[model samples]
Target: MFRRHGLRATAAACCATALLATPALAGSDGPGAPGAGDDYFPGYGNGGYDVSHYDIQLRYQPTDDHLRGTTTIVAKPTQNLTAFNLDFALPTKSVRVNGAPAQFSQDGTELTVTPSEALPEGSLATFVVEYEGVPSTVEVDGIKPWIRTSDGALAVGEPEIAAWWFPSNDHPRDKATFDISVAVPDGTEVLSNGVNTKNASLAGWTTWQWRTTKPTATYLAFIGVGQYEISTKTGAFGQPLVTAYSENLGELAGPAKASVERTPEVVEFLTGLLGEYPFEAQGGLVSSEGMNFALENQTRPTYSHRFFRNGANTSVVVHENAHQWFGDSVSVDTWRNIWLNEGFASYAEWFWSEAQGTGTAQELFDHYYASHPADDPFWQTLPGEPGAEEVFSKAVYDRGAMTVHALRNVVGDEALLDIIRTWVSEKRYSTGTIEEFIALAEQRSGKQLDELFNTWLFTKGRPPVGEATGVPVSATRVAVAPPKAVAEIDRTHALLHDH
Candidate 1:
């Protein structure tokens, strides 16, 4: 996530006016544990089950900001299960497990469902949950991740947006395929991840249908319901490219279009380095709403209009799409390993800059290395193991990129790119860890890199200015600032990095 400074919560508390549908239910049993064992977010995903796919159907009325939905989940329990938990905040009317009425209750965002009978280990079970609520009213720790726009709603965020809009396992560890269909007024355009398989219109409402065959993290699945100027085109590699611009964007529309329309070019550029483009489609959505951050939501990314405030900026474009390979494809096993996402994506910005004749990756690395002094607090946060509060800190982003640059200097360009390609291919649709990445890097480069990684990623001070650390303060160091886009990112790093 890339955030601008001074962004405030924009959702208003609206009452849900949709009528609730009665659900079948029997006697209640017990609720399952509410976490999937990630220490950073203990209550995120429930344990004991693996989700295979989700079929979500939603109806939204922009006038009242009310949302109604039914979500069907296909999953299997790892062990015999009487009940399981789904991370959701909407008020549920009813729930069914395998066509039988199931007792359900919600404690905060944890929706505990007790099926009529225990599911046998390895048996596939189906869960159907019907819910209706005003998504803007849902809050977690005083933060509301859902963005309610004037024309419609934007269901986007990191680590937590799915709970407010739909029931989910709610973690990167439990990735699943998605078929999301959103029904809205005729004039509204609904944009989501993956392909637009179909669109059906009835009366004055239209249901925008979309599906993703690839396994995607719940946080990466999103929907934008609003009035948008939609465009479709074939990409450089023959993949479908879809881009949307909010009709309300005034002066920012041109710059946003100019930058995002280059998605094909950017994807082709990244493909040369990261092996192949992982997804089937490529696109971007530029919201006119005053959002401070841009999110990489699976196949299509959502950008804040503020990213183009100065002018056309493709660096942020590179950052979010680079996430397709780093954060989206090969996800972090745990949130603590976030540098694997942010660092590599940030390094992609440097790579793009060099390709555009703006700045070399080394020049960008050296600029950041010299910018922060030894006593700077920026060096205090360890990028490899940033705690919950510091997960999106500047250290995780810039220092993380510095770490990648340092690795490139030590491993050589060919070895570093090969290591990245191998890592992407090996961990294609699953999660990865820092340890695994370290081992792979060392193995591929034929180097003992523990000290180098530890000094840059784990230690709590500015690394020495030397070749070993990749910040050689020799005559090669030129006194030049990075491009405006990078300088803008540096300026925004001091702001909130909300998911």
Candidate 2:
């Protein structure tokens, strides 16, 4: 899974138009290609149909951590479809197409279905599935998927982790809207992606229905289920905001609240620095799940207890929330272009640091560059196409941000921010690739950046000495003095030391 999580929503007929299928005509009879032709993870993402929306309804039994689910998908065929596949992991009870029982079989993660009637290209189809099993954490290519918590679950579906919890074309390339409804025991609660449309109790169970009003990638779709203390308020942009945590967190709850409450101000800050916030609502979630990672999940970001342990790491918050623009809005078209998500978010930490006078981007870049030895393997890694095993490697994070720093050095701070703002505005609710970013940088900076990219993103060795990427010493004085962050850092240290 590509990390630093963020992405999603909405039911639009136009959503079926992800990478329009031109191979087969409307009347041409054929099977849609499985796996949307991705260079990495060839087995993920089914071919043949473009899904418009997903209606997922599941009931979780806390006692056994068992989940029974019925999922309905609305999609359009790219080729005249005889059979299609959904990447599902749970044991299947039944499957139906257009209300008629469909022949279905599960082979590993893919749930293949043969409809009674062939679906013509451009025609809409509905496939529904019923399944029940204890949802388990999946280990895919050494990546963690849906993690079962002490009292709940966190769905972190980077790369192909989505299939662990729900069945669908589990790839970022195939984006769709979602309506997630989860039912829990009487005392339990659920917080998922998008706006809560319904919260009702029946027969000693409560069902929470959420609707996402934006096209969401399966990896970005999420469901946090268990006993949660839910809070709602207006966000920075006045969007509907929601945050959740459990009493099980104990003392960490106080710091979690304080850290999450900073979201409004963070959004406002990033909004001015980047562009407008992408989602209609904004929030965050804290869980006992020990993912040791925080995900920028659509409108709501999810954090691990470790973050709250140190008063919710503002740097991590800056990293994830920045994903709203870089990863969530201007998503990567393929897993190969993950640097577009992580690199920008990583650079955002530098941006926060610079603004608060903690450290400049160049200072951070210098720290990493100087700390690592020449042949330390870190220098040999590339952020772009960092093979499967090293997808989330430091090369994708620190080096990626260093690449941004190098670019910022070339284009200057103002042009860099302008280029980012432009990229966010242009690619909102859509996807882009590394090449597109390069082109955008050149266009915005009016300078050739090919060399910088080659040295930072493509090279397998340390870049040349002092290859340009530091602001003038005089400019450092312009940054705001760290009065508040200093206090906050002290408070966090006290919290951690107290425990």
Candidate 3:
């Protein structure tokens, strides 16, 4: 029973600004709330406990797309708890609480557990859930979770994909460090977030151990297991830039390698614009898996094989990589504020295009303003308040980009970069709400932006720009260095040697 988009929340009528500042009040003595009380996905994250780390060990069988795993979740309850819930979707064989077989029952996606002893406030606890089944992606409102590749699997758990593969808190706000080990047969390699500390072989199988010490939202945690041509390159700060592509991608592998090879160049560009690259290592994956979209999965972003097309531009590349700063590192407090991710990344594309000397952000902003009629759904929809399905709609991507451009027009480029740096520096590795972001903007720009935010983010219909702040500083058409076309890669020989 999947809905097309997120069902409208029936909870308290809360706006993005209101939903973001929700404090985690200590839980009562009874059972915790089945849901985390997130205004967007009520069935998502759980209450009472806060997760600190996840040690996920998955043994995958490619023949039948089956996965067997034991997930170890380390958490601390905020209040005394007799029972708590975890979001798990795979068929579980057994469950244990801190090595004890706790009484448990499953209802839908929620796995409710009553521990042998009641967990008191500030008490540490662990849950080990043994699950095995053909983990299918959660499909709702057109957004699908994991992608089942031809040979193995690719797990990109944005929104609710993690629950489909592992039992844990399945919301963006509940971030945790991860030690992910995906064991696979020889010929298939496992790629995940952060640094690859272990890749040891035993008999016919290899275990790939990836550790991300940085706290990561569940949505950004990813795993890709497939036959790949892995490449390592030196990036900024001399971190290894690791990329992988499915061998079966055929000609698609060429553009994929090309796009991925530019990872260093993109990181360098983004680092100059936005403080620094947020993760330890930067890399990418190009796969035959048929998820048409690209995800900003923490350190390594994943792209579909389709984007390797000759016509496909690196704007998507710029977009997803920009998410490393906007989405991955500085997270949204609620799904309602997803525009903070999409909008910033989308605006980064405009910045890239402007830097490339072809189109100015001003020109792109004007074109959308003129081309789309006033009543176009793109302009009519609000990013601060999106329905389940409308999360990534034009309001999120295009108009979101437009919102950033409008900000740039308000504060000059230098000041805008200052505001951005302040945001990422202060909110890095943490969740924030729209109100906080608005306050930061106002403080940095010394401009009361209630009208501006209300016009662009909150209200619907075409946003009006008062004639005062509409004028943009002179943007000369200067060719940005590292002269690779948006769609074309400078390196061609990289593809010839891909094995």
Candidate 4:
């Protein structure tokens, strides 16, 4: 049976707001009010656009059976446009812009709105979307959204699943800041991006206000509401960070805390290695009910309860933590360049492994190289390749890790570290493409890498190995070894050389 990633199946609800639902007064400041700013607009086609600033407020309430909310987004248009389009990734019940009813079009996955009034370049525009629905189950392939049994856990993966809860761009390229307020059933907890600015109690419901100061990719935006035991800590930079796990999983808290307690250390390590921690307001981790792998949501990294099963290994913690630097701090401009996110995260796994004495960094490279398909067609496939379905594929993850490893080999460890540090320092709070990364690597390494990348990235099959060339051997005396074993041995030898 075909399986869909959870994000793709349940994301339909995220785009469900109607474009021209109601007209509101331009100056009216209601529950969902737009903030003062130049009408910020995101470019749709060509190179994706950036949302430099946004002031938005959302009023939401969730009953036992249904979730409802209205969002007002004030955006400054970065580019000139006569018509403004905002993406509601789900089916919308209603939409209005600047107190005027707007025309909307839908393609199931996107709700595009065109305001009745022409928006001038650099003008401020306000968009409002009101929606209500039964919280959809996240489904991908056959995998369904599930929560881990551990305490205070909630994660939204399957990229862009947040749209199921709110109208959004649902694409990674479009980045923005958000002010999210959510009301959950009385006694339940709610978690989201940014710092918790306010909390208030209403009739049988609790309201939470979360404001993210950093620019964020739409996919990294998140919300989780349920009963959870809250924990807090301070990073080396003194940034306040929090973690919430289910009360029932209280027993796992110690291990979970121990596993992640080094978050500050990891952050510091990455800051020294990469540049600086990208999101400064706060960082968080929420254990979620799910059998799938962890989802590196910005600020808050959602993890499966199982991850805490074995004392929250250093490798896993570092992997997710690394994302705060690579994925969250320096986001990929498009899904095709997802390697820029996942690959770096994967590489961090090796970096942590090497640091913790689990293995040398070269060992990690050999492991990935050994696992790579000899006849992989990933290089020939673009980010939006016809058959490609998910961004977490081997091409984006493992192969991408190998690319970084190869770069390290090409530039040596110290220089590779310098390149990464510069990349993060230069691109923090911004988005980058693969070509830009390649250029950055070249500049830092002081060496041409086009041929190197072509051999590993563009080739249809694995490039010829140095010693793999045909050499006559005594067939009768030749020793035969299992392919897997031989591969492992070869990798280990390569690792020794690399180290």
Runs of candidate 1 with Cα error greater than 4 angstroms are: 4-32, 475-485, 488-499
Model 2, 190-293: lDDT tens per residue? 88888999989999999999999887888778888877899998888678889998768898989888878788888888998898888878888888754666
Clashes of each: 0, 11, 4, 48
Task: Name the candidate that leads on lDDT.
Answer: 1
Residue-wise lDDT of candidate 4 within 393-447, one digit each (tens)? 5455555666677777767889889888888889887778778988988888898
TM-score of each: 0.92, 0.88, 0.88, 0.77
lDDT of 3: 0.76
Candidate 3 per-residue lDDT, tens place, 1-499, comes to: 0011223443453354235324345856867667766666767788888899999999998877889999999999888888888887777888787789998888667888999988887988899999988865444334446568778888874676787778888777789999999989987888999899989889898999999988899878889888888887787689978898888888787767766788788888888888977788888888786565678899898877766666445776787788888988998888788888888887787777778875677776766566566677767778878765577665677677778888788777887898888999899999888889889988998887777778888888877646333423322223343224322321111221231
Sorting all predicted structures by TM-score, with the top scorer first, yields: 1, 3, 2, 4
User: Is 2 or 4 the stronger prediction by TM-score?
Assistant: 2
Give all candidates' CA lDDT scores. Answer: 0.84, 0.75, 0.76, 0.57
The alpha-carbon root-mean-square deviation between model 3 and the true structure, to one decimal in Å, is 6.0
Better of 3 and 4 by lDDT: 3
Q: How well does candidate 2 score on lDDT at residue 340?
A: 89
